[model samples]
Target: MGGIDREKVKGSFHRQAKTYDQYARVQKRVVANLLDQVRKEVGTPGRILDVGCGTGKLLAELHRLHPEAQLFGADLALGMCITAGAHLAAGAFVTADAESLPFIDGAFNLVTSTSTYQWLPALDHAFAEARRVLAPGGIFLFALFGERTLFELKDAHYQALKREGEVEDITHRFFPPSRVEAALAGAGFDQWRVESTLEVELHADVPALLKSLKKIGAGNASPRASAGLYGRKRMLAMMDIYQEKYGTTDGIPATYEVIYGAGRCP
Candidate 1:
């Protein structure tokens, strides 16, 4: 897997910190579904740690559910951590990387993340770190984008560029459910379950879809992604291509293939 540019990712998310919550509908939904699953499978955790807890939405939710439990959040972006801390005046927030958590072994009973792992180049390191921090028999629950995520947008970009004998790769190749399961197992997790889901959001046009991504600071952080901002010509062409191919009676649909995984450290 190609390594992600950490500074680039931090900058993007930091820039969107103030406005992220407005356009993070899909992310919020992922957190909600993940929490619901946690509730169904096990009770509220005694101590909770949310990796890549952007904007602290999930932390706020967890706080609401288990007011007495200890809660914490960490993210690579300082601005995101600051914003999260300010929003949720209770939880302890820190700037940390998932591959190398700034905590002692078995520091948390439950570790979770949503829409964050795809940005990581090595799932093994991250999973291992999660396992290290989790107590014995503790649950690790997470949701990540799978390979099929943003296919429509990706396809549109390729097709638009191909018209001029060029190729545009603007997104990361997200890990599949099978790969994620293998990574979790390799990290010493047991009885893990991985499931795939398609979450679709409708936009009136391609620009709106792009705006949604920008608002959530989700512009690709892949090393392969273009460093420069998109040009007007290419942007317009992609919009046309997407509308021509995947447009429905309602609107253009941006599909997110969400991979949900949960298991226990043994």
Candidate 2:
């Protein structure tokens, strides 16, 4: 994968800041599952920092879970940070990139992110930063989209582009679980665990899936994505390909491959 344009990523989430929660059902589920894991492994962290804390939903829940702990949130998008501030009464929200968090070393006892690492260009740098910011034995936990995510859409795009004689990449190359675990280990984390699961989400149609993705600020931010708006011909071709191959009696299926990672900075 090529380097991601940070400004474009910030812009995408900034535009969706207000409506993200409405369309982020899978994300909410991921957060709930992550919190459950946290409860099992770590009862309460003395200090917490949520990287890429979009709208601070997890932070809010963490506060309720550990009312006495200090909570903080950081995101690359300022609009998201502002929304997080409005949602949380006492926690501090900062606009910062995950790859280079602007915090002192050993500042947090727990660092977490959910459904956000896929946009990052360098997982190693992000993990290094997370490890740098965590206290000794602190937990670093996160969930990211794995390589199988959106395979339905990806296959459709591939076939559609091939038919047009354009063999170009149109999606981000999501990391596999092995790569994620290697980065965590290289970043000085110990006692690590990485798990992946494939989940299928049903959408009414191709258009509905696209709309849901846009509403949640998860539209294709890949630099390899087609340069211009997909014309009606391409759109129809992609939709037809998707429906013919992956559509079900219930609806069109969009597959989500989620990777959950947990480690302690040693």
Candidate 3:
């Protein structure tokens, strides 16, 4: 939390907002599961808050499920907020930081986030904020990428870098399920449950896969700007290394470790 630069992170998402939907297939799938779990936990919430609600895809679905309930969407990206506003059904769309929500305490009956919490610098504070904004007995449901996500690619990248006599961490940052569960508990939430799942997909090559990740702005998060680090030579090297190590009988594979969790505010 202390090391976070909120403005930089927000700007990063804003820059990629226009193309986010194109590469959000993985996110969409995870969010669908999160929604199903939320439905099971609470039949129909009277009011819902969609935190980090990227292009409002999940919000659109929620609107369909509970047409009468008040809905609100919040994200750090202004462009995403505008895009979501155009598609969502008469709901308020605000460009706001998830760590410090601009709402009164107990403002929502249910809070949901998808593929967004991993971007936060402080999961603990974010969980506290989620709990703070929810009414008593409200449900908080979210899906986030975990440490196991992109393990193959990360290992390949590291190995390649080591071969080139470079020591670099190309892995995306995310908390494990146990840490996430502890954060929720420390934030004073009750009835918490969390689980992890590995979702894998095949790609023709690393470039195709990297393009998909870039389109969603889900690339490296080292705060070291992509323009310089993601040059042609480095990219080609990464592809070659990935093919050499992880290519399967079908094609090159990518795995995403998706962590889903829900907690109730008591």
Candidate 4:
């Protein structure tokens, strides 16, 4: 695969603007954890920039914590920007890409994101942008899905395809902690630390899980992904495989490997 189709990804989030927060349970948890970590590692930020600030959720929390600080949000999707701007009267929202921010060097004292970077195929440019936009001693706090995230779903789909005499790998790949560390080092971000945590969400079944992902604008936007993933036969096969392999009496579990990291500008 060349890389994630950014336009498609933008469209995905744009289409889900109305329902994003309703279905973003995992995202809410991740950002809450991100905020807690931010409070622990950094002092009062003068100017904060939130990358991929979908619907201003993180910005809202930051505003709640630091009412005196300035807030700004950036998202590639115009719909998301508009949605975020609607409720956040205190912050400025802009349509911009994470790989190439429109801000000046050292424009922000704190940069934050959550449940965003996993969509990018590579991290060099995005990480560099985060580092570039941070002032000296500023901190970058972020949480992204790690490689182990959604393993059961990937495994089930692979087995479903294999049983049907097909061979393909269409699921989107998430970066591991090592790659994240490497990207931060490459970006010249100093005093960095990264950790992985497992967070599991229980869904009614495969279809429900798929719907949750779609509603949250987390659909697989990989160029190599095909319609076969949702085919009736393949989907049903996947459901059975998933239930038999990873299900519990409570419900079917969807595992998310959340990788949280923080770095300071030297």
TM-score of each: 0.95, 0.96, 0.93, 0.97
User: Per-residue CA lDDT of candidate 1, range 152-202, in tens?
Assistant: 998988887887687645456788888998998899887798999999999
Clashing pairs in 1: none
Task: Provide the global lDDT of candidate 3 against the true structure.
Answer: 0.83
lDDT of 2 by residue, 60-110 (tens): 999989999999999988889999999998799999988889899999999
RMSD of each: 1.5, 1.3, 2.0, 1.3
- Give the Cα lDDT of each candidate: 0.87, 0.88, 0.83, 0.90
- What ranking emerges by lDDT with the best candidate at the front? 4, 2, 1, 3
Name the weakest run of 10 consecutive residues (lDDT summed) in model 2: 222-231
Candidate 4: the clashing residue pairs are none
Model 1 clashing-pair count: 0
Which pairs clash in model 2? Answer: none
Which is the leading candidate under lDDT? 4
Residue 238 deviation, candidate 2, in Å?
Answer: 0.3
